[model samples]
Every structure is written in C-alpha cells, then in structure tokens.
Target: MSLPPAFLDELRARVPLAPVVGRRVKLTRAGREWKGCCPFHNEKTPSFYVNDDKGFYHCFGCGAHGDVIRFLTEQEGMGFIDAVKQLAAQAGMEVPSESPEARARAEVADTLQSLAGRAAEWFQAQLRSTAGAEARAYLDRRGVSATMIKDFALGFSPESRTALKTALKDAGEDKLVEAGLLGRSDDGQTYDRFRGRLMFPIRDRRGRVVGFGGRALGDIQPKYLNSADGPLFDKGRLLYNLDRAGPVAHKSGRLVVVEGYMDVIGVAQAGIAELVAPLGTAMTETQLALAWRQVDEPILCFDGDGAGQRAALRACLRALPLLAPGKSLRIATLPPGEDPDDLVKRGGAPAFEVVLDAALPLSEYLWRSETEGQDTATPERRAAVRQRLKAHADAIADPSVRALYAADFNARFDALYFARPERPPRQAFVRGARYVAPLAGASPALRSRGPGARTASGEVTALLAGLLTHPGLADRHGEALAALPMSDPRQAELRDAILSALALSPDLESDALNADLVRRGVGGLADATLKSNRLRFSFTRRDAAADATARDFGMMVDTIAARTRIELELETATARFRSSLEDSDFERQQALLAERVEIDSAMMRLAESLRDD
Candidate 1:
C-alpha cells in the first residue's frame, strides 16, 4: 500500500538512522557519519558508512546502499511492509489506513504542499517584477546579492491584500488558509497573510517548502512575521535553513545558530554554509535537539545586545536538562550593537570567524552570567552565588554530567573566594632534623590550651605529607583541604602549592605533583614536612594502601578542621563572656568549652588511630 510522502518524511525525521543501523552494525562516528565493517560482505576494515544528515548508508566493499527502511528490508531480510510497520511503531506514528477518508486527507496535504511550491514560484516571479521594486531595493541596500536571492529562493509578496489570494485562487480559500498562505478574519473575510514583505521560504528537513518568514519593509509594527502554524508547520519544532545547513554542518563539523533569517542568509552568503536560525522565537528544545543531531556542539552566534544575551541564556537553560556527554552548545557574542549579518558584512567572514573562535563554552557562559559584576565579597553573598551555581548544576538530568558540573562549580567557588592567603617565606630547614609528633593522650589542662597543646604545626605537616604521598586525595577533598588552617607559613605555602597544582590538573599523579611543587620551590618544604611526620603517621607513608590511607587522611583532616573551629569558637566565647558578664554569655562560653574538649578528645583518638594503623 502506498503512503503519503509527507507521512514518510515525518517518519524519517522522527527516527534517527544511525541508531537503527547501529543495532545490526557496530558503528563508530567518523566526522558527519557512522562507519562500520560491511555486513553485506566479510571485511576487516570498515567500508560501510551511514550519514544521518542525508539518511542513507553505503558500503564500498559490497557495493550496498539503502536508507533506514531499505537497510532493514535488505540487510535484516524483512519485507518492505514489515520494515515500515516496525519503523512506524518506533516513530510512534500509526500507519494511515487505505480508506476513503485517509486518502482524502493525504490528497489535501499533497495539494497544500503543491500550492505552497506554486506560491513560492509566484512570489519569486513577482520579486523580479515591478511590483517588488521596494523589496528589491531593500535587499540590495542590505548587500544581498542576486545570486543569494536566487539560491535562497528569496522573494517578495505584493502590497495588495488579495495578491496571493488572487494568484492561487484555484487552490480554494479554505485550502489556502489551512496551508498558512491566507488568513481568514472573524467576519469570514479571507486575505493574504504576508503582504509587501521580503519573503523567506521555510523548508522541512527534506527541503520541501512548508512555510514562509516575511520581513516587513515599510513601517510595519512586527518587523518580522512568520507563517501561521498549519498542518505542515510548527515554528517551535522547526528551524529555518535546517534542511540546507545539515549536510554542510555535517561536512564542516560546525553548525552556527544565528538570530534570524537575515543573519543566516548573510553568514551563508559569506560562504559559511553551516548555519540555521530559530523561527522567530527563542530556541526551543526541539530545535536544539535537531541541531545536535547534525553536530556535537552547535555555536549560538547571537547578537551582543542584552536581548541576544537573554536569548542565549534561555537556550542554555532549555538545553541543560537535555545535555549529555559530548553533547552541548558553544555561544558566540557579536560586537555590541551588531548582529551576525552586520559583523559579517563589516569585516567579512574573518571577523565572524574570530567571534566563533572565541565562543564561550556553555558552562563558562553560565558561570559569567551568575558571577560577572556581582559582589561576592561577603560570605553570605558568596554563599548565594554558590547556591545559584548548584541550582544550575542540579538542573542537569544526567547524573555523571551533573556531578562533574557540581564539582567544577564548587572548585571555581573555592578558587574565587576561599583561595589560600599568601604566607611568609619558609624558614630554612636543616636536613635530617627530626621534629617530634604531639603527644596523643595529653592531659585536660594541656588540651584546654587548644590546638597549641596538640602541636598544630605537626598535624599540618602530617596532612601535607599525606597529600604529597597521594596527590589524588587533594582532588577528592579539595574543599576540606582548603579549609584546613595552617599556622606555619611554610606549611601554608606548601598547601597552597598543592592546591594550585591540582587546580591546573586534577588528575595529576603523586610524582608529577611533587615535581611541580619542587619546581615551585616547595620540594624541600614537602621533604622536611614528610621526614618529620611520615614516621609518626602511617597514612603519610608511600607504602600504605591507597584506600586505607585516604580513609585515615580524611579522618585526620576532619579532626584537625573540627579542632580549629572549636579553638576559634572558644576564643570568641572567651571574649564575649568577658565583655558581657551576663549569665547567658557565661553559659555560652561554658558550652563552647565543653564542645572544644570533645573535639580535642576526637583529635586525640584520630591521632592514636593513625599511629596504630
């Protein structure tokens, strides 16, 4: 049974070809297509190739060729009807029944599509005629060449309300309205929808004219008007120039999304063919998915104005939930007061190329959007920034990508606000000088003196030694490490050095980290710290099991951090009790003292555990 061409087209658009072929053939991405060994014939090297943009597969080895349906019919040995049925099920489309009503509906769709093509032809003819003088002048003034006019099938609608209506009178007013070529008023008066405007034909993925976008010429309120949603057109789901841009984008490994048709036309005229535009709206999720099907990261080259930036942000937010590994967007901002068309027209494609080259990754753009020009001086303000960043990170649906984003944002936050303060130069350390570890079971009287009684410097040394032994620990517990208070200037310097190295390369091995630290003049500091403390703490020893060392190192860090917090609280409480001789202040001080004692006891237990391990 024959099916409507439009139905077949929709089916093809809905079902991606790569995944269909991939179920049978192990395919690897090769530029714009998937390549695999030919299943038609035994071959060691991959000769079969699938191009999703073009929706076809070919094999040089066996001289095999077919589309998705044909691939199943021939390769999998299924009948044509069975293949269509299975694909229709996958696409969630029911097969049109071979009934009179279905046939009539199909006929009407075909007729409307035919009328749209005819309307385009009439518009093109009118563009070259006297009726289109104003539109022609407008195009010429905008630097649109005649060749571009012909190539893009650009035309002009006459100023007469009934111009298109009269030209396509035989198509019937009802059919014309359904095709979005004519609009019917509430009083039942029918008229042309687009009048006296430079016309841009909007095509489907198969390059069939489905709708039109018109730029008003003379003092029109809505400067740009698109064809009303009809049987064939849904602006939110369709992108202008996608049909032509897909193949070009695939071949070049680049797809640029501009603001409007003029920007797309201007950029394409400059010989950059891989470009598209949303249909008179901020980019919708469907449009983004369509672009992603062609390229991994499509560049959004919006105008540099506030509106354009807002559009970019909306697109970014829309895409966050849909983002996956290797699937994302890059955003390019044109100069202030310039759109892509203006930029390209001014400095040629090179200027536009520079903007594209300098395009920021979506993550960077998001970061700047939240943090740029915002005051992060106070802890509360910085925390607010962090909460906003976390909200964005959590918007990502994929767990792995979400985790990575959260980690990256947290790292940036710490780097921006909690960066280790500079410390004095390390005092000269004599080689082979053994520094004793603080006693694990100190008396309550000594412990009351806070971390001072615990030899805070020795604990800091051990922590640094553990980090030097296993640089990976720094990556795992960066925030914790950054929060650790180091009184010794030498240890603080070494800790900062480690963090800086990890910031550069989070996966840096122990040897590379040590070498980097050594080059930064912290090698002796690390050596001195390790030699003095490694003998006391087993986790600092390079021979210890990594998992066990990490656990012990984390416990040691928590214990030290807790002790530091209690010491600060104790100091604050002491001042408050002295300043206000009130009972509440005294109770607060006493409570803090009790908490400090507990923390000190925990630190002692941690130290004893590390020594025993």
Candidate 2:
C-alpha cells in the first residue's frame, strides 16, 4: 500500500536533516548552515552544502540535493516509505494514519515485527534459563560456546507444543496469527509452527530477523529441518549464516559456502567465521550472484556424500558461465561422508581450513578428479577426456582463466596421454563441451540463419532499430512497411520495442533505449536488435548510399514483419481455446492442443532466430 504523504512529510519535519547528515560528513559552520563532502558521489573537495535554516542539503559536485527523505533514499538504499518509517522512529514519534489502506497494512507489519522481537527475546532468555538446559547441552556437545550461540541469536523452543504460542498470546495473539506463528484449526484453536525444537533465527544479510530454522531436539523422524514457508522467508532464497559470516567473508577475501546450517555454525564457532550455506536448496544462480557481490572467490565445500559429489559437480558447472575476470571458484571435497561441520568437530577448525586451502580450481577439480583413473590409461579414453576438458575450459567466461587453465591442462596431459599412441594437437570443438539444460523439453533451435536469410532479417531489424532510435526515419519509412507479415514473435517484440522507444524519446541513446525495452519485457530484445544494427552499420557504413542502406534495412524489415504477422495469427488460434469445450469435445481439445504446441514451437524458433550479439 502507498504511504500517507503527510506521514512522510511530517517524518521529514522530525530528525532535522542538518543533524542527521551532519554526523556523517565533516561540516563547516557557514552562516546558519554547513558544508561537507558529497557522500553520494566522489569529490576531491567539499561541495555538499547544507542549509540548517531550511533543512535542505545540496551537492554541487553531482547535483544530488534533497532533504532527509532523499538522503535516506540515496545513502541508505531504502525505499521512500521505509525511510519515512525509520525517520519517524528516530524522532520518537508515532506516525499518524495517512490512508486507511496504508494504516491497515503498516499496522499488520508493525504488530508482527513487534511480536517477533518480543518472541526472539523470550527464546534467547530461555537459552539462559533452566528450561533451555537441553538446548544448551546440545550446543555444548556440538562444541558451540555460549559466546557464539549468543552472537548468532541461537536459542531454544521448549519441548512443550505451545510455549511460544502461549507467550505470543499474552504479548499479542493477533500478531501470532499475522506472522504465521500460529496454525488455526477449524474450531479456532491455534498451535505453534515449531515444537520441541531448537531455534536459529534466520536473518537477511542486513541483519533483519526474517524467519527461523528449527532443529529437532532428539532422535526423531526428520532431522535438522527449517521452518515452513512464512510471510518473511522463502527458503530457496535465504542463506544460512549470511548475517554472521558475510562481513567476515568480505573482509577475509574469500567465502566458504558449506552445505548445511550446523556446518556453518560449527565453522564459525571454530573461528573460521567466513562460512555460509544455502537454505537446503541446490545453489541457485541468484545465490551465486549474491555470493559474487560479497567476495572475489567462493570455495564450495560439499559433503563427502554421493549427493554432495553431484552438488560439487553442479557448482563447478554453473560457475562456468558466470566466471568473471577477477572472480574465482574452488571446490573443496571432504573425505567420505564427512562435511565441514563433522570434519571440524573431528579434526578441529584448522582441519577445515586446511581443506579449504587445498581446494582446487573448479575446472581442475572437475576435469582431473573425475577422469584421473577412468580408463585414462587407454588412448581413446584419454582423447575423450581431453576433448571434454577443452570444452569445459572454453566455457569459462574469463579469458585469462580459460587461457591459464588450458595451458596447465596441456602441461599435465603430455603426449604420454594420447589416442592410438599418436601425438595429437588440441582442437576447438564447434560447440564447446559445457552442458546447458535445453529450454524445457526441446533441443536448441538453430541459431545460424538459413542461406541468404541473415541479410534480409538483419537489414529489417536495423531499419526498425534506426526508426525507433531516430524519429526522423519513421517519417520516411512509415508508409512503405505495412504490406508484409512477420512470422516471428521475436520480430513482433522487436517492432514493439522500437515503437515504444520512439514514443518515449525521439532521439534514443543505447542505455535509455535498452532500459525502456527491458521495462516492457522485451528486455534483451533491444540490445540484440541494436547489435544487429551495429553489424549492418559496420558492414555498409563506407560508401553505401542512403537508399542502399534503407533498401537493405527494408529487406530485413519485410522479412521480420512477415514473421510477426504469422506470430499474431498463431497467438489468436490458441487464445480462444477452453479446457472444457462445449462443441467438439475430444477432437476440439486435440486440435486446440496442437495449435498451442505449434504456437509455442514457433515462438521458440522466433527467439532462436535472433542469435547472440
């Protein structure tokens, strides 16, 4: 819900900007005002001046100037509504209701957050009390000290089924209901979500207590489980130990992503505080991107289980395409069935550290470890492995890493390792060795255009791109382009992106054009189309007549336009289908399914028609 504007305005009134921003920068007294360096932008000298009289701040360096609301939005990376909420809290002032909807929603979040805060305190309090004896003992047996448990906000949920439910009822049961802490029966009886479990408050990197991970206290059916889906937590996205380990990982220059939560806790407790874990899901692309942002390299320590070995292989595979120039990925394989946590317990944290230090680069590990003894003694087997190695090496996104790995791989596998006992030279495969899951159920569509098909489509996209990029072309070409049909959906999207870009801005630059297209959901379409335009430009820029360029553009445009018309026709056929048809029954259903399949297949082809820039 949108916030009441007045609440935000009043929030701006409280916690006067001069004082709030003054503490962050070196401010000089300048006639009822102050001046300091612009925190938003880099500046050699102080150009950020503040007027205490008006509660306004301005940076002459980058033209970033605003009041407290703007300050929080720019500096703290907070939304306007959240910043106002924060500023209101700073002022010790309750934000008066602005709108009915905003009031109701904010009240819900506020009440739940308050209830969670109180509940967290109670749980931590229990860890010190006698009721928490078992939980404390469990941690002690696991070698987690009081200091580490306290630091991680670790605590116990008493064996009673409703200890937290009763506590939250007294504090506020409405909050319990809202936060999903209580599960209601048909008769209105409520029970706790977690029972007889040890609690670990799951936190976001910013240290907000979003949810919880609960462990079964004793031998039970399921072991070491986390809370089910809640309003605040999505297990797939959350990383255990991120709050405690992120900074240390960032500071220490490497992150260790172990497979389990206790392993994270164990490693951190052992003073190897740079450990993190995914919330029991496979390491996803989103997690990789988030991990990449915090550190230069990540060492994945999968357990010694078979599943762990597969996970380690997957980590190497996924990291292949995402390997950046400076970033590195290393895989640390633990001994059979032992994880970092178990290893740390048996051999101490130093043992885990030694394993991490011995971690090999992902490419090296995947190529060498898997193929070290797999019939490599035979020439044919070595040839197959070497070919696969070359393919994986080619998949590395960083050129330098690829080059260095290639050199090292060649040095390791000399002529002594060969096929048919003949000396062989390294060769580049047409398509590299990395395996990409096909788009759903189908194989990769042909990316290369059919003979003479490329030039016409290329010209058309370039023309549309120019018309969209420069408004002047639309005036010249608007009338000559309406006769033919484009049979591709990607062509339609490209045309739409061009038209949309033209409507928003007459003289479109690259960034603005691409951003507008992305906002419209044909995100990368504009970039690909523009790259095609660049190709056409480079090819024909010298001594090509304006008419020739336009003619070539016209050719490509007609081809794409034809594809787009066909796309709309196919879309119309599938849009009118029903799950339960009244007319022809099975025959209609089968026909509808076929039409839908064709449309989908056609769209896939259309997308593939536009290759990588």
Best-performing candidate as measured by lDDT: 1
Model 2: per-residue Cα lDDT over 371-480, one tens digit each: 77687666788788778777776888775466455545654565245324434533322225322212121122212322122224554565556554544444345444
- The lDDT of model 1 is 0.80
- Candidate 1 lDDT, 201-223, residue by residue in tens: 99876577889999999999699
Q: Name the regions of candidate 2 deviating beyond 4 angstroms.
A: 1-110, 170-178, 184-189, 376-613
Residue 449 deviation, candidate 1, in Å?
44
TM-score of every prediction relative to native: 0.58, 0.51
Determine which window of 10 residues in candidate 2 has minimal summed lDDT.
437-446
Give Cα-based local distance difference scores for all models: 0.80, 0.64
- lDDT of model 1, residue 504: 43
lDDT of 2 at 403: 48
